[model samples]
Structures are given as structure tokens and as C-alpha cells.
Target: MAAYAGLAFLSFLWGSSFLLIKIASRAFDPFGFALARVGVAAAAMLMTSAVSGKVWPGSRPGLWVKLLALALIGQVIPFMLLAKAATLTTSAEMALMMGAQPIFVFVFGRFLGSSDRWTWLAALGLAIGFAGVGVAFWSPGAGGGAHAVLGRAFALAAGVFYGTGAIISGAATREIGAVRAVTASMTISTLVLGLIGLAFGRLPPPVTLLEIPLGPMLAMGALGVFNTALAYYVYFRLVHDEGPTFASLNNYIAPVIGVIAGAAALAEPVGPSAWVGLALVL
Candidate 1:
């Protein structure tokens, strides 16, 4: 019950993250924003890990390789992609399209996830969820090449990456506790984002520092410390306890809150398709 409750709350926090990224991306380049967010998350994790006496993954060579892969798929690539996509897309569209996640997790989680099969109800729920995704994407609002489409595509791509990472994290969590797994993943993502940002000339420009507002900074700090770190920690525990099938339900719950938040906070339109999608999913 504790784990379930924690996972539910985790979804609520994470639901708003896409909007925060949209705000942060305005201040930093895509990779730069990704780098900064994950960088802050990593630094926070490092400090917490030190205080908590969690294993430093570098302490074990064998685990290090496994940790590295977890970082790449779980954090490094998808996060940057998400930030880039959010920069282009509307939050409502992004939220609505995320209704597809349960399908992604169900399909992927069945064959690829540690769990070999899912309950029929889970499958049916995911079918409804995918319908929602279609409605959200095909609505008149999503048809034209609006920035929302790019964002949707990016979010979709992130979903695929996120699914693959879920499978891997599902497996990896067996050996390492959730906190350690997230700590290692955040560190890897931070480093990978940093390198990519530098390689692509996407690093935060010098003006970025001066331009970052205190409000956004506070928001980012909350995101890095609470939303990203704490959310993942709770998620890892849920995944470890309940299996990925149950753990990834957060995706399903997230879109509703996300769309509402995007619409209310960002003044973005919730299109016909998005409405259609949300209805089907719920």
C-alpha cells in the first residue's frame, strides 16, 4: 500500500515536469537544459548517496558497466530528447500523447519486461489508452505541422526509449536498490547530456546563467531534487516490488493532470484529438 501510494504521488509530480522543461528550455539550449536539469539531479543524488551510504557504482567494475547502460537508456538520451521535444511542442499535446505509454509499457513490458505476460484487464486498459493517443494526435489540432507535432513525436520517441529503459531498469533493480539505480542513472545522464551538449554546440550559452530567474531556478531545484530524484526513487521501489507492469501505470495517470496543467498554466489548447484521447484512456 505504501509503495502504491508513493507511486501515485510520484506520477502527480512527474506529470508537471514536461511543462517545467518547456519553461527551462526557453532559457537554455535543448541539450543545455537537459544537461542542467540532469546535472542538478545528479549532483543532488551524489550528495544524498554519500550521506545515505549507498554504494558508489564505480566501486564495482562489473556493476559499473551495467550501471552505464542503465544511465544511457534510462536517463541520458531520453531526457535530452524530451527537453528538445517539449521546446517544440505544446504541453497539452505532449500530455495527451503520453496516454500511449501504458500501451508501450504493456507491449514492451510483456515480451521485454521481466514479467512475461500481463493481465487481460491491463491489455484492455492499454487499448483504451492507445485509442486516446490516436484521438489526441489525429484531432484537427494535431493534423498540421504545428510545434505540437514535433513535441508529440519527441514524447513518443521518449516513450519508446522509456519503455526500453523500464525493461532494463526492471532487471537491474534486482541487484541494486532503487535509490542506487537512480543515483547511477542520474550521474550517467548528467555526464552524457553534458558531452552531447558540448559536442553539438548546444551547451548553455554564457547568457544562460544571467538570464535564469529565481523562480525558474527554484522550480528546477524542486524538479531536480524532488520530482526527478524522489519520483525515480519511489518508482524504482514500486517497479521492484510490483513489477514493471504495475509500476508504469504512472504514465496512464499522468496525461490527465498534465493536459489540465498545460492548459491552465501554459494557456495551451487542449485539442479535439487530445480530448478524444483522454476520454478513451480514462
Candidate 2:
């Protein structure tokens, strides 16, 4: 029951994240935003592990390499893509688009030969979900323009990356323990995103940050502490306790919260198709 409660709370945190990301993107660009998120998250996780007497996984070059790959696929790439997409699309739309992640997870599970078995019901769910997504995006005029199209594409691609990351995380977590796995992965992601920021010249000069809005700055910090760090802690426990598919069930809960939160807080419009898509996703 405690585990279930934890997972539910984690879902709520993640559901609220789409709106936060959209808010934060106003101040930080893609690479910089991702870098800051993982950097602070890594710091928090490492501190928690240390305080809790969790031993670090050290001196394993192979494990580090695997962690690097997980960080890239799960954290860096998806985080950057989603952050970029948030700037272009409404939070409600992005949340529903993200709700399609489980379908892709099942598809990838087949290729990975994980325990996921697709039945007729699963196929029906997939079909319904895809149809719903189509309806949601099938709007008239500027709402379905090139930028929105591209943003939705990015969101979907992030979902694929997230699916692949889940598989990798499952294997790594089973071996190294969830806390250590997340700490290592976040550390690697911070480094990778930092380098990417430098390459893109998006790493802001320190003095320039004074001009950024306080609201967005606070949003970014909350994103790191609540969304990235604390959420990953709960998620890794879920993966370890319930398996990847079960942990991924947060995909179902979060988008609903996201839609409601976005509409309430941001006055974002939710069309009939969006409701259809959300229902199918649920």
C-alpha cells in the first residue's frame, strides 16, 4: 500500500511537469535547461544516497558505459526534445501525446524480448490510442501548422526514447540497485547535457541570468528538485518493486493530471479530440 501510494504521488508530480517545463522553457533554452535539471537532480540524488548510507557503484568501467547510454536515451535526449517541444505546443497536448508512451514501450519490448506480450486487447488499445492521437492533432488552420506538427513529432519521439530507456533501466536496476542506478545515470546525463550546452553555445553567461524571470527560474529549480530528483527516486523504486511495465503505468495517471493542471493554471484549451485521446490513453 505504501508503494502504491508512492507511485501515485510520483504520477502526480510527473503530470504537473509538462506545465512546469513549458514555464521553465521561457527562461532556459533546450540544452541549458536539460543540463541544469540533471545537474541539480544528480546532486540531490548523490546527497540522498550518501546520507542514507547507500554505497556508490564504483570502478566498473562497463557499468559507466551502460549508464552513459541510459542517460543519453532516457534523460538527455528525451529531456531536450520535450523541453523544446514545450515551447511550441500547449502543455495539455504534450501530455496526451506523451501518454502514447506505453504503446511504444510494448513495441520495443517485443524487439527487446522482454516479458511484454501483445494480445488482441492490446492491439485494440493501440489502435484506439493512435486514432485518438490523430483526432487530437487533426485540427483546422494554425493549430495544426508546421510548428505544432513538428512539436508533436518531437513529443512522440521522446516517448520512443523513454520506452527504450525503460528497458535499459530495468536491466541496470536489477543488477546495481535502483538508487545507485538512478544516481549514476543522472550524473552521466548531467555531464552529457553540459557538453551539449557548450557545443550549442547555449550555456548562458552567469551575468545574463539576472535578467531572466523569477517565476521561470523557480520553476526550473522545482523541476530539478521535485520532478527530476524526487520523481526518479520514486520511479526507480517502482521499477524495482513492480517491474518496468507497472512503473510505466504512471504514463496513464500523469497525462490526466497534466491536462487538468494545464487547463486550470494556464487556461490551455482542450478540444474534443484531446478528450477523446485522453480517454483512449486511459
Candidate 3:
């Protein structure tokens, strides 16, 4: 029960992140925001891990490779994708697309030799959920435009990456423990994102902290502390306790929270179809 509650709260945290990212993106480009957010998250995790008496694992090439893969797929790639998508679509749309992550997790887990068998009930749920997505897309005033389609595609790609990440994190955490696994992954992600931002010439035309508004800076900090750092801790715990397929259920719950948050915080539109879709997803 405690695990379930933790997972639910984690979903809420992630749901609210869409709003934060939307606000923060006004100050930072996709690469820039991803770099800063993950960097802060890495620092926070390192500090917390030290305070918790969690020691880093000994260097192993294989372990480092796995950690790198987890960092790239889980944090770097998806976060950049979502950040860019936020500029083109409503938070509600991105959240709804992410809600489909469990289906992909189940599929990926099967390919990875997970013994969990798929039943008709799971299929029905997926069908219903996807049908909801289609309804949301079909609704008037729901779709943004060509850019919205592209944004939705990117969001779905992020969801696929997240599904893959969950499977990897489950295995990685088993070997290294959750804190170390997250710490290493976040560290690597921050480094990679920083390099990417530099390569894209983000630094030369840098937008300094003074230039950005206080609201966005605060949002970015909250995103690091609550959404990235604390959320990943809860996520690792859920994956360790319940398995990846179950932990991925947070994807299903988060969109409902996101729709509500988007409506309340950003005054983003929630059309009838979107509401119906959110209900089906829940």
C-alpha cells in the first residue's frame, strides 16, 4: 500500500512537470533547459545519496555502459524531446501521449525475456486507452496543427524511450541499488546534455540567469528537486518493489493529473474529447 501511494504521488509530480517545463521553456531552449534541469537533478541526487550513506559501486565497464544507456534513453533523449514538444503542443497532449507508455513497456519487456504473459484484459485496456487518444486528436480545437502532429509524435517517442528506460532501470537498480543507479545515470545525462548544448552553440549566445524571469527559474528549480530528483527516487523504489510493468502504471495515472494541472495552471484548453480521453486513460 505504501508503495502504491508512493507511485501515485510520483505520477502527480511528473504530471505537474509539464507545466513547469512549459514555463521554464520560455527562458531556455530545449537543449538548454534539459541540460540545466538534469544537471541540478544530478547534483541533488549526489548530495542525497551521500547523506543517505549510499556508496557508489566500483567501476565496471559493463555497468557503466548500462548506466550510460539508461541515462541517454531515460533522461537525455526523452527530456529533450519533451522540452521541444512543449513549445509546439499543449501540456495535456504531451501528457496523454506519455500515458501510453505502459503498452510499450509490456512490449519491450516481452522482447527482453520477461516471463509476464499478455492477456486479453491488458489488450483491451490498451485499446481503450489508445482509442481515447484518437478521440482527443479528432476533437475540434484539440489539435494544434501540423506542428501539433509533430509534437505529439515526439511525445510518443519520449514515451517509448521511457518504457525502455523502465526496463533498464529495473535491471540496473537490482545490481547497483536505486540511489547509485539514479545518481550515475543523472550524472551521465547531465554531462551529455551539457556537451550537446555546447555543440549546438547554446553557450555563445547564452541566455543568463539574470535575463530569465524569476518564475521560470523557480520552476526549473522545482522541476529538478521534485520532478527529477525526488521523482526518480520514488520511481526506482517502485520498480524495485513492484516490477517495471507495474511501476509504468504511473504513466497511465499521470495524464489525468496533467490535464487538470494544465487547465488550472496554464489555462490550457481541455476540450470535451480531451476530458473523455483523460477519463479513459485513468
Q: For each candidate, give its TM-score against the true structure.
A: 0.91, 0.92, 0.94
Report the lDDT of model 2 for residue 267: 89
Better of 2 and 3 by lDDT: 3
Residues 118-193 of candidate 2 have per-residue lDDT tens digits of: 5888667766776666666654312567887788778878888988888778777877888899899999898777
Candidate 3 residue lDDT tens string, 57-157: 77989888889999999899899999998888888888888878888888899887544556889878876876776666555535556888788778888
Q: Could you report the Cα RMSD, in angstroms, for every candidate shown?
A: 2.2, 2.1, 1.8
Least lDDT summed over 10 consecutive residues: which range in candidate 3?
135-144
Error of 1 at 235 (Å): 1.0
Candidate with maximal lDDT? 3
lDDT score, candidate 2: 0.81
| Model 2 segments more than 4 A misplaced | 1-3, 116-123, 140-142
lDDT of each: 0.75, 0.81, 0.84
Better of 2 and 3 by TM-score: 3
Residue pair clashes in candidate 2: none
Where model 1 places Cα greater than 4 Å from the true spot, the runs are 58-62, 142-146, 198-202, 205-207
Model 3 TM-score relative to the real fold? 0.94
How big is the RMSD of model 1?
2.2
